[model samples]
Target: DSNFLFLFCYSTYSNKVFSVTFLSLAVAVIIPLFGAIILLKCPIDPQPISFKEPPVLTGPLEPNFKLRQAERLFENQLVGPESIANIGDVLFTGTADGKILKIENGEIHTLARLGHGPCTGREDEPTCGRPLGIRVGPKNTLFVADAYYGIFEINPVSGEVIPLVSSKTPIEGKNLSFINDLTLTRDGRKIYFTDSSSKWHRKDYSLLIMEASDDGRLFEYDRVTKEVKVLMGGLRFANGVQLSPSEDFVLVAETTMARIRRYYVSGLMKGGEDMFVENMPGFPDNIRLSSSGGYWVAMSAIRANPGFSMMDFLSEKPWIKRIIFKLLSQETVIKFVPKYSLLVELSDTGSYRRSFHDPNGMVASYISEAHEHNGHLYLGSFRSPFICRLNLKDV
Candidate 1:
């Protein structure tokens, strides 16, 4: 629109001039974004998890966790939801189908298709395995860390998806098959993310214990240098990656282990990592710090489905695991049914502060994403158009 746009179009990101265009807003409206940037640096003011004496609920009526169907958007299914990012009022989520969604005012719409593949019927096989992590920034920039295609950036309004970082360079597809959550540093100089597993894609979660591979890793991408560096290596399903409100520490969810760990960025414990919460009631999928305080943790499933848990128990027998997987893969006539419930909300230490669950399997298993926007918690699935919204005030 103006020369001011071209002259400063590619601002330095990571290390180089990346693809984002930053427009200074009267300088007054910039405060909030700046405040969010500051969130990336506050020292890790961790509320230690007293494991020796885990907190317990002493009351009868815990918040009811139930899932009531709301509405439908597409006839297809969802993969794992890695991270849910809110931009303004639009809630954008990335899916296994290589697509990102723009949920506006309670209506569903596709924001951009990041990659392609067969799981969701896309022509390009590599782009379609699954998309997990997504974040929206001040200028409406959408950054996504996909399971198969690595990392991507998109224009929320135009559907222009760009490959920002892929396993092509330092890390290869063989190294990062399940690229998980991602976050931008407060200064926007570095982008951090995780690869949940090297041996398991969303379809192969059953193999995590079977393979026992030392694969999960955390990485930092420098835009200015166009280099992606490893921060933490060898994790148990490196699932959720979030920066502390102060931007001083990075919190990562080890879903396969049902615990959240904090990696310091700046502080007395820089480079140190410790447990924030462990043995979540269920497998922790993703975590978001609420504007009002407290983190919303989504327990992907209260427990692995009986069929899957059975496989875990029979791990010594590979043939049994294989046979069961094959059977359950085709167990349904309609391909899916509302069978179980997955709820996520505030957790008071080891206690459940409040939760939302939708059984009957309507919400499905292997929930990849969950986030809280305003007072409503949104859920994205790995199997159906299982996008859901629950009123968090009930908690």
Candidate 2:
């Protein structure tokens, strides 16, 4: 299937012992690493949605008017495409499939893979560890936020792999679980990353909501000082940290709360938090500040299930959440109408001045981090393999 984004790990990458014993029970959802498939009922299939495109805005964009998708990037489906940045004339992508791909003009190239090349077609058992956010440094090195392995940097020229951080036992005793997204400081002296949850897997979204206790955190790793500091914590899935264009403040999105909070680094509000944007339509994932000002907040996907917005309250009651999980966890196919608008919030007051969206399900999870490179608007999708240049005029 061309749309085989979520493939069975056991079907391709199982160990010797696993292949011999767990081969026959195709009925069970065999987790390749955990081996023992937890017995569960079958899931339902959801119908694919079709979206409508937004109208053309030819003026200084209106904060008050409605908007929709201006252009569609790569078609079909790709998984978890994160941050998008450029290295000279080349474009690169870090995917949930554990691969980093290079793009030039409008063509695709396999830059490198975590365990194998793009064409090696290796079966999926957690090889590259799920590459998430990716950014190119000044020296042309690619830094990636890997799910299980922590932060990593790969030499774009040499294709050499280097580990920047991981959860291995330190000289002391602690664990950094699920390092999700990342960004660099103005001078590139520090790396700021998000640890989404300590006791949950990315696929188990329901469990994360049930146990949400503001467990996510923002960590800063200084390259020159060779130090790591816990900048902020007790956050509900702290995601999408971006350095303000002038390097004055760092803005982070709390997905569970559907809001972005700013931590001032060089202003009167230093060491305090200010509201950036609140009551967003979707769960915000990664956000980037534009060169001109304002930030591109990637609302990964809008909240459909009512429980998504009230995670804090839901986490307090174990029995209530468990009952809901048990009832809804059976479906194989999950469906929802994509939220039809994306806002370009103002940097000063976090007010929406411009927006984009559509009526169809033209997007999905962790769609893409929006970036204003040069004078053009480039749209990358978390679920699509290609990058696109949009003809969106200024609002």
lDDT of 2: 0.59
The positional error of residue 278 in candidate 2, measured at the CA in angstroms, is 2.7
Tens digits of per-residue lDDT, candidate 2, 194-301, equal 877665545444345444547677777887786777777777767678877666777888876677777776677766667777666566777876654677776545
- lDDT score at residue 3, model 1, on the 0-100 scale: 75
List TM-score per model, in order.
0.70, 0.71
TM-score of 1: 0.70
List runs of model 2 lying over 4 Å from the truth: 1-69, 76-78, 115-126, 169-174, 266-270, 303-320, 330-343, 363-366, 384-388
Per-candidate RMSD, Å: 26.2, 15.2
Off by over 4 Å in 1: 1-63, 69-83, 104-109, 117-129, 172-174, 304-339, 344-352, 362-366
Top lDDT hit: 1
Per-residue lDDT over 1-395 for candidate 1, one digit per residue giving the tens place of the 0 to 100 score = 67766656543342242222233443546787556554443211211111122223223212233545433334354444445678878777776566677778767787766554455442243656456777875567888877777788788888887787876454744467677778887666678898877656655554563344457888888877878877787677787777777788777877655567778877898888777776554566777765555566665454442223332344355444344434443334123323455555444233455555555555334455557777776666655555666565554
Write down the RMSD of candidate 2 (Cα, Å). 15.2
Cα-based lDDT for every prediction:
0.61, 0.59
